[model samples]
Target: MKRSSRNYAEGESPRERIVNAARRLFGSKGFYATTTAELAEEASVSVGQIYRLFTDKDDVILAIVEENVRVRLAEMHSIFDAVERRELAMFEAIKAIAANSLHNEDGSLFYEILAEACRNPTVAERFEKQTAFYRDGIRRLAALARPDVPAAELEAYGDVMMACFIGLGHRTAMSPPVDPEATSHSTACLMMRALGLAELESGRVQTQP
Candidate 1:
């Protein structure tokens, strides 16, 4: 693995370095193809250092998955807070989310991890847990948007919304390039309608003509 010119902080620990290296290598070369020696070389640490910090490569992958999940959950909380406080409109938030989901580098990493989860039981377990956490956050956001909707129905909406986001990610990764702005606008409109926010759709039409 080739090292980027960017310097790691002086205080950055070997464990952190190894996990970061694993994220890049795993995302690029894939979990199965990437070897322990490559990971050690990329991190500028000895193979022994990796074993001291993690049981094996899978442990390192899990650590990266956990970190990614934590950061994304925090972002979701921020989005929920903004919407709850009326600092951000629900449609606008959805648009921003769709755009990020399609364009962000981490989006590719997320899909890579999902593929790994299919074969690795440990990764699959952690992935499923993080997915549940993500779904719960979406459910809460839906409840905030539709206070009158029953919890059961809101949960269903969350499931469908997550499916839409995942499908959008795959679509964006396909060969024919996708227009981010158009995709965001259409997804936001679809989600708003699904959430029973007809007023937003009406506002959009009223502004159009």
Candidate 2:
């Protein structure tokens, strides 16, 4: 495929391109492995264009993380909406969470940044804040799904769910070509089992008519 021109100027769509390129590179390679030059090359722009749009590579990374969080929050809201009116089972909600969290290019990229954040305080702080936001989201979602469950238990469950997500992220980063669908199915089953849902606890997720 022919790359776009090197022409970089204000008011153009270079910023968006740069963001997208950075996201792809960071997701595929990793934060540490990705360079500004690579981001520019992927976007078919110049390195100076990236600097003009952002302060540095970390700034671009932060933007990517923020955008990722925004997208996930939107996904969570949609999931909440779908479950709000109906008599959906708890396992169903677990399934929805697992399905949404696990199946995505964005999730894969987020894991890359997450691994880098472990060593850098700036990165780590940003990641922690994002995780907290997600935890709070899970907490609220869990409460809504299971009103009978205690608030404390809901919080604990949310933490457990987040822990499971991070562990899955690590697995995906290490594994070659992570299978999103399989991971989602496995996670939903595991979560249901952990919640002591007897039928689901058996790890059989096939829905019978």
Candidate 3:
């Protein structure tokens, strides 16, 4: 109950304020537990303004998740681009991408949204959109890493890799890694092996000397 609250309206638009307030309140309280009145109060906006900006609290939650996905997808694109341009190594890119997935700073907010997705078709659709992007990206990465492999086979690898990243986010949210860098690198290795793209790296493998 004793948590710091930020000025939800500090230079943000009415809609942004409402979404921000909902993210904090819904994450802390819950979707059904929090009300429009509470969102209005936290956002420092009139109740009417909240309604005008969003159809309901569900709308605000959708906005929050959509924004989150948008930023994350952009980052993914950047990492994929770097790999394509040879600006980053394939292993390093996978490690960077896996590390990015572990950022769950909002704690249970991600879980709350996941629950919301299960109950709400619209929210679920947004989640599906994110999954499609990730799956496609994985398939593309696989093709580049193992050009000899057929696309159909790579498609299956993409689905499994996507699941791994998604599950990793949920897992790390509950039990954070002690050494995130090591975790990410290990994840990269596992994922690479999954795509038949494994490679040997010195000093990384545990050498029982």
Candidate 4:
């Protein structure tokens, strides 16, 4: 199973340890710069163990991406649940999701993955698989949106959300911190308005759908 976090405790499985180490090392160093030997050393596992658990460095990166997508989907589901329970407004949920997209360093990892994928066929294939996995997650989220839109409409929402969220990651990495909350709010409003879940009042977006 993919880990929800990178924390490793006593008696953690070798595969889990290896994945966690790879996540950290890959985050700190470019994918091309990190070698299997370094991964083995950081994971506290033998090179043999690394190979036994994963096909190669590409496989390790795939595992990391899969885990990241799983966590994001779970968080999105929880936010939706909160909205259903009336504990969170739909606008608030969108803001939460957008803020999360802006807060992470996934953009750097994304570019690093692209660079590695260009040089290695296996990495390219793995990247494609992980992207499909994330795309499916987005489709599920779109299906769950309020007012029960048609399949084509849901697909459009998912497409817009995915593209904008990925763009936000790049924006976060490139831009200086300038009222992140304001940026997140506007982005959230855009998504909600597009989804037909927002109504404007007093020149401000209402939390309700």
Candidate 5:
């Protein structure tokens, strides 16, 4: 198996430190504007150390994307498990996801990577791969949540649901802050209607503990 890029000497890991610094700088200054020297300074490590951990700035960005994908996949799996166990309602799951998207730094970093993917083929390829990971997870979750739905229809529904969340993430990052609770409720209602679960109105879905 491929080893993690996070290998480090005894004590604090420079790899984690570098990734944290890069995430902040990239989110604030953007991928193209942020330089390796700045990253080294922010990370409190030498430029050589950054190089030792990553091939270059793009590599660092890819590493960040990979980490985010791993985290998101885990969250998706948790949501799926909860839904499968009947511990969480579908509408509640959507609401929880929307609320999380509103305040997370991951949303901003996601947009940054998306912008880079437009001009950089390497970033584009990685972006596509990571995106497929997300979509496949969503497809699985949709299947689990609505097994009676036809497979083709479930696939389409999953794509639309994923798009809604992505759009909400971008809007939350760019627009003025809004009430996450309200946004979640409204979005969940619409998603339920769209998913042909209109019989189960927003009022009927109980929030998971």
Candidate 6:
């Protein structure tokens, strides 16, 4: 993971500290239970400091959600860029997609906020925008993968991919620790079926774990 260049100076930005602390704490405790006071303590600042940086707990959560979306979108775009550049084989690309969804730092937080957004309006807006971004990214990639498909149908295909991705994310979010690679391979196979692509005759997908 790349560290931010922001120095731990005499007067470091409160917002940066709060965001970093929130990312770390929320990754561990989740959104519903992680309190503002706890976040303040984690940030090494007072609760009022948190308020100064953000309007309220929801605002802080929104900032976290936005940051999470920014990172995940960038990561997905990178993988898609490799696909666009023909730098990765189809199977290798699918693996990269799977690895990114489950293994990336912000992915967990993305899903956490998404789940919470079910009840919270502020979070829901961010979640909706995040969904749109992924849908757009997927549509672009699906078009690149199969140019013969109509644009409208390709858009639906993109939606299907997003659905599969979300399902994979939720499976990982559940307890008992689901296997990301297996889930991803299964999803890729299903996508192949949907696209009428040739599946492996051996019905084999290499498992990473």
- What are the Cα lDDT values of the candidates? 0.75, 0.70, 0.74, 0.75, 0.78, 0.69
lDDT of 5 by residue, 44-134 (tens): 7888888888888888888888887788788878987887787887777778777766656666777788888898999899878988998
Residue pairs in clash, model 2: none
Better of 1 and 2 by lDDT: 1
| Root-mean-square deviation of every model | 3.9, 5.5, 4.8, 5.2, 6.2, 6.6
Model 2 regions lying over 4 Å from their true place: 1-12, 106-111, 176-186, 196-209
TM-score of each: 0.84, 0.74, 0.84, 0.77, 0.85, 0.75
State the number of backbone clashes in model 6.
Answer: 0
**Please, what are the lDDT tens digits per residue for candidate 4 over residues 13-90?**
999889888877887787878988888878777888899988888888888777877887788778878766767766
> Which tens-of-lDDT digit does each residue in 122-194 have in candidate 3?
8899777876765677677666665665777867766777787776666665874647688888998887666
Candidate 6: worst-modelled 10 consecutive residues by lDDT: 200-209
TM-score of 3: 0.84
- Which residue pairs show backbone clashes in model 3? none
Cα misplacement distance, residue 10 of candidate 4 (Å): 3.9
Best by TM-score: 5
- Alpha-carbon runs more than 4 Å astray in model 5: 1-12, 199-209
lDDT score for residue 113 of model 5:
85
Better of 3 and 4 by TM-score: 3
Which stretches of candidate 6 lie above 4 Å from their native place? 1-13, 24-32, 104-112, 199-209
TM-score for candidate 6, residues paired by index: 0.75
* Winning model by lDDT: 5
| Candidate with more favorable, higher lDDT: 1 or 5 | 5
In model 4, the runs with Cα more than 4 Å from the true position are: 1-8, 118-126, 143-149, 178-180, 199-209
The C-alpha local distance difference test score for the whole of candidate 3 amounts to: 0.74
lDDT (C-alpha) at residue 175 in model 6: 48
Write the residue-wise lDDT of candidate 2 on 1-209 in tens digits: 34655554666488778888887788778777887777878888787778888988777877887877787778776777766755455566666667665555666676666667876788788877876777777776766645667778878877887787656645544566656777776777777666645344543333322
